[model samples]
Target: MTSITKRKTFLILTSLVSAIAILLLSLKPDTAIMDDQTLYEKLNNGNTIYYLVVGDSIGRGAGAESRRDSWYAQLERLIKKRYGADMQGQHISQSGATAFEGLYKLKNTELIYPADIIFLVFGENDRKYMEPEEFAKHYELLVREAKVRAPKAEIITFIESPLAVQEFANQIQAVSSHYGATAIDMRKAYRQSGAEVKSLNRDQVHPNGKGYELYAKTILQTLDEFPNRKAPSTKEALYVQEDAPLHVTTSIETQQGFLYKEPYWTTGKKGSSIRYKVQGNTIGAIIKRNPNGGMVDVFIDRRYYRTINTNWPLVKERYIIIAAGIESGSHQIEFITNDHGHRFNGLDEKPFQLAGVISATINSKGTAE
Candidate 1:
């Protein structure tokens, strides 16, 4: 009960509290990126900036504790802040996806969302497996494909550290130059920025938290060189399902076809036919695959486009392209079940199983600024 005793206890408690606060601060990110209120304002008052990030595990944040802590996430935050826009981040980077697979994946996203800016971070998986020349060609194809899919989108090819040696980096540079895309060498950036070696994750292939922070910083700094495009005052997005009113079909059945959490999947009979009228340059489908599935033919505007096989041993959800690089106006997409020469006889009952459809309805007012 003595004054000195009470004062000593209070002092000890205050010291502990101070230490705890410092520890907590150290555990948090170095600086506050953005708050919910700021993000809401950006989504409402600002323009719409659709940002797409594609690549392998590196871009997928394999080494980071949380994916939101990745470089792309950080860059997106800064982009929204600087441009004052509703920057929608579309990340299609899978862990094991290579350049070739990435291309197909990109093709799969044509109608889901049209990106305004695209960041391609690949090459880690292709290090020892593919030749530099071949990889470069494939990289070029990917860039060209992105250009064809979203002509107005800015394509950026980002090369990461340690593994991006001279030969590999040169290939990437060649591809970027050929396609008129920008390539950022993170290794050079890290060195010039004076980041430490500890930024590398314990595995050394991927990056740690600090490394991702530096990565974001380097990318943001590079992007600063380009002028920010003036987006529309108001933006709109649309996602349509196959069974929606837009579809005019005879054979395709709209019912609970798959186990996934979806609205409806268009199950195809032997002679099933489904059609959708969409208003966009790009078109794609959300499909489900199973061992009992078959092939389906796709047609764009009455022209035979391509045939997609929906047969797989395992069941999974997939995004498939119906059409891209078409004129932005009223268009029709038709799907017909083409089940023939079946290796698995069990698929005779159920043939084509398509999940949904998606499209981003861009304004016809004017081109993206």
Candidate 2:
């Protein structure tokens, strides 16, 4: 072989290698280019960090023996030890909350302060009743609301449970990417841990203490990888209107056959009803759920909407979404008690109770009624 021919082959191979490197770099997701030591140094600046957690049962630290054993609690403790920073956590999570419920709660509740970090720990309960698309819509709305409330906060979405489907996790990743947020898939960490996933869980659904430790470890490792990641600015274009109007009705209605019970209006007799006039595309209610709870038929603008059963195994207050995606305009919503012969612990004539009503418009202009 001639010297020129050998030199030409080497040049071609060098060019091919350069092209492969460029392609790999382009395909990689944008990540913070800092070492662990530098990241820890930045975090250990002695500044107080506020963390806002919003989601379902896992976010509320359910199934853990104590609050200290929960994932977030452990994460805070580890962050204090490793980063030498003080952390405060605020939780707005419910045990059986879905994405819709989470959104409703976020809308109704006021933030005490702007958060430094926001952890969205949903998907387990959402996957049980919501399709991937529906979950994405609600999740995106939740993220939008979080951004508006804390414009500079770092948003992190968690795919925390093994029971959550891949499709749900995919949607979470897609939405997070679109919003410049981060999605941490704990399933990957669980798989890499080489531990039996089922054994980590306390029961069929909730995780045990060891499982929560894994969750904290996974979150910390993921954060270390992207220490300088920023959440999307609220000034940027958002899927949801930042100033969307939400109307809440807490006043008692003067209706026949209904007894005012401090916070709620209770009626055991069938056909008893309460009405509220609200203007929005979405309607929800804060109601009481118990084993003796009965059925309530909903009416929108005097038209029959849907029947909601208020029965639960235990007595608790819940935000129940009555209807969504309706036309934006003034509408009268009525809930009529329709208790059939449903027996709970041999008790007949279940009662229906209403605490408050809420309505929200997506992008329409309206004032609270």
Q: Using TM-score as the measure, which candidate wins?
A: 2
lDDT of 2 by residue, 1-369 (tens): 999999999999999999999988876643233221232334656456778999888889889989999999999887888677777888999888877788877877888856778899888877765467656666778888888787777888888776558888888888788887878887887788898978788987888899899999888877667665455575442334434555788764446568877688888788888888887877889888877888889899889999888887777788866776677788888888877424565653246878888878764223232
Which regions of candidate 2 fall more than 4 Å away from where they truly are?
A: 1-42, 108-114, 127-131, 162-167, 229-231, 235-238, 241-243, 249-256, 290-292, 299-316, 327-332, 340-350, 363-369
Largest lDDT belongs to which candidate?
A: 2
What's the TM-score of every candidate structure?
Answer: 0.50, 0.73
lDDT of 2: 0.76
TM-score of 2: 0.73
Q: How close is candidate 1 to the true structure, as a TM-score?
A: 0.50
